[model samples]
Target: MAFDSQWGLSATGFYVPSYEEVLDSIQDDFIARFGSDIVLTSNSNFGIITRMMARREKASWEEQQLTYYSAFISTAIGTSLDYIGGNLGLKRKVDEPAFATITIATEGEYLIQAGEQFATESGYVFTLLKDVVTTQNNDGSWSGMGMVQCEETGADTNVPINSITTEVDPDENILSVTNFEKAGGGQDYEDDETYRERLRMENEARPGSTAAGIRSALMNLPGVREVNIVQNPSNATDKYGNPPYSVHIYCLGGDKGSIAETIADYIAAGITLVGSQQLKVKDATGNKLDINFDFATNKPVFAKVVINTDDAWNVDNGAEDVKQSIADYINELEMGDPVYITRLYPAIYDIEGVTDASIAIGTSTTTLQEKNMIQTDFEAVTCDPDDIEVVVNGL
Candidate 1:
């Protein structure tokens, strides 16, 4: 009877979809775009979890975008969860990327000396070739004066050579090799060969034959770490081309300022013997004479100084100390640091007491201490009452 009453009302039934059908509808679309290797699940939530797990596994194995994105999302979720659970990871990574630095070191005085030597050599060579004087008379006769000019027998070019086997003697006025050569060329052909040989012999007898001697002289100076020298034959047409030379000095590690100053001082003290013009020999009564002399001058020569650190950026823990020492050295030498140089890192790092909590707590403590000191009797002096009372009683 009751079943008949229930049947009189509207009939109702439950509809349950198949797991395979639902999974095929949703997961098939996902797999078409993503891949067929993806796993299908009965539950939507379970399908999502499976997809995430698959992506994470793939990402872990093959550093692909899908895997990377999944891992990043997982990490974000995991980190959030861990933070909520109060489990922070070990240490935060420093933001600075890795890099390397270079530094140079040299002495200023050494650089100056090298430069001066270069200049002196340049001048000597220039003067030797350029300062020639020729006198032409009305009879169409040409006479050359100054250093002796010798004619090359084979080359037909004028060569200058000193005649004296020793230094130029004050009493003797022997013809210059250049003059002898020219005279011999005009007088007899046999004399030309003799003069040419004499010029070659004189050149061979020069004090320093090779550029190595000049480089050695530079190296002998203080604070010179490395030295390089170069020499080339000057063009015969150019004034200084007759005897050309070049020098370069490389100082690896030293006080550049001090070195530069020392070089300048040495130059000022006239340690280098340079050419200058002087009056010819004269009698006691001051009679005019035909001789000329090479003298020394006090004029300061031009030089260039370059100072640098050997390796600036690779200092150890003691870098600051070393850098300070370098700075002090520079100051002592009276030179400023180069503009390109800068502090690679902070002079000091607060690693001793730096913690997330300590920093916050220390800030609060400092504020409180500062506030309390504002109204304190900082200027008031206190006397002991017992000591005062004893003093009064004794009085």
Candidate 2:
């Protein structure tokens, strides 16, 4: 009886049902009566129901049409979010922007020879030669003075005025001077203390000074944007409160591999360390550039890593796979022993598709519903190269 009332509609004389009738039909409908409004409603009611049904059907059809669409979208978004969550990846993308910062760590001894002494109004000239020597043009009033000088020492008073001299041998005490002045003719114009101090200052200011040498050495490498010398106060002071000297280099441009190689070559060429140690370049997040040098042995060690991943349709799944692959690859790398995970990232892609089929009496053919799942690739990496091992286990 309830089904009869729910399925049956009171005949409204106007050919189609009213808004009220449709509502009543939905509330009362039992099975077959549910769709009765398709034929019973007035034009306006019929049109409204038809449009609403069409939209609802479209959404439902879309869901069934593609199995992987949602999966792919979700994976991409989720993986990217995870990557950004790590600080190193964020800073690298933001601060480094277009270039990568690389650090070269090395240690070696330099062979230096102190040059001839000369007299000038400002002071005495004592030229020091080291490595394959090349001289730069002298600017200002001090120009064309082949040698740098300091105040004459008493020991040099009896020596010949124009005598050209050469200094001590190679690999000697690091802090000792290679040459010294014997007693000379003029009023002991150069004081050894004053001479040494002036030379220190001049070498620091000269373009061929230790700082300049390091800069020049690095600039010779390809893609080096610029170089800066920074002093580290923490290590700058000695136990006796004397000022310790150090060189901090700022390097930009080039990928990690090229930069590391250039640095190794420079170390092998004999750049001396001002103090007992040196500092390397680091990112904003304090991630150190890949570089190593053995000062004791005068040998430089370098590490290089390359990562590649398969295409991924899902971010979460793809990132996992990439993380695992990177870990596995790193384990197989010989040079990557000192390497640690530094950062990870997710690259995402979007895909879409649809299918429709129909049949008519004239065609006399049956239509089958069609559906498919789209495919895509996702990529990600671990921060520490060594962490790749851990990622493999987790993946």
Candidate 3:
């Protein structure tokens, strides 16, 4: 068969000729045209030329294959993905800084100005979101709460509670600084896999009161991590106490108002919205209607990792590195996704000196889990760096 005829779109799928196949086709043509008497060994100059020609032809076929795949979301990547996302009205999310509330105690009445930087021991810096003026308390000390945002983007800034203890530039009046709650909402730029998934969802999403459509719309919102909608489609109230034809939306990490508004826009009229949290959203006629949705609770996943390492391992930071890696993987999981102990192997092995590792995960520290930790649809697994304990066996 001709080289060109062997590769291209077939009934099965897009196909491309391998390097060896292309070379064989070229040699067969050469022998058919010039007769078998012609020298055709790798040592021969003609054979070398033939091999080079085959390589070039194979490269062209690969490029054509890439072009074909690039038109579809499933296989497209990088700039091609960006192009498809733009056409679908889906812009890739950029990295966002983490934000948390920090408590500032002062020896005397002091003003914690906006832009004052605080840092964790690991050196992640965060700036106060707004000015916080301290008020005198009964004991003559002053304290106030201030919201702060990490100066940098990414998950590393989502430090654990009490991690932000250092003041980047020490202020004499500000006696101490610490975060009682873990900083959250930090995210890396949406990767190709995630972006492609979103594109697929958006492409299939229709404009109507649909579970998939509502979930897709909510997922596109900034800070919205996961969304699950459970509908009681029966004529009577379901076991979950949802009224007839009611939907209970469980979402994690999105503005409550935005969630309410999006639910209002997508939900069909006369359908009862069910949840614990309620927010008033304006309807199309500018009338306010109460919308309800439950914020998915975080199922804190504690892990104990024992790693066998060699001399090549980074002794000082290796444990923390492993902890952070595990935390990152756990935090990235969507709502109700089980915490698979086996899935953490890749993240652990990615560390330079890790030879072997064993991981145990559970919802609480008291109970140990060998099997995957399952969660309800309204729960998302959360793992703080501090929650992950790493032990190096052979450091």
**Per-residue lDDT of 1-395 in model 1, one digit per residue for the tens?**
00122222134421222333333444556777778776566356648754555445433333333333333213223333223223222111111111111111121111111111101111211112223333444665443333222212211121122221121221122222122211111111222223233223333432132444333332333322233322233433224222333222232222233223322322212122212222233334554333211211111111111122233323342333433433332222211112112221122112121111100101122331111111111111111111110000110
Ranking by TM-score: 3, 2, 1
Which runs in model 3 stand beyond 4 Å of their true positions?
31-36, 100-113, 118-123, 129-147, 156-184, 232-246, 269-289, 305-334, 337-359, 364-366, 369-372, 383-395
What's the CA error at residue 287 for candidate 2, in Å?
A: 15
| CA error at residue 62 for candidate 2, angstroms | 5.2
lDDT for model 2 comes to 0.31
TM-score, predicted candidate 2 vs. hidden true structure:
0.18
Query: Which candidate has the highest lDDT of all?
Result: 3
Query: What are the per-residue Cα lDDT tens digits for candidate 2 across 75-157?
Result: 22333333322321211111111111111111223322344222322234333322222223333111111223333432222
By summed lDDT, the worst window of 10 consecutive residues in model 1 runs over 386-395
Badly placed stretches (over 4 Å) of model 2 are 1-44, 56-395
User: Which tens-of-lDDT digit does each residue in 1-395 have in candidate 3?
Assistant: 34675479988878998889999899989999989998889999779978989989988888889998998899998999898888888889788888888999998778888999999988899999899998888888889999888889875566777999999888788888888876767766888988888888888985358899999988887667788889988899887778898889998765566778988888888888889889899988898888999878867889888889988899889999999999989988988888888898999999999999898888777776677898876899888899877888985
lDDT of candidate model 3 versus the reference:
0.85
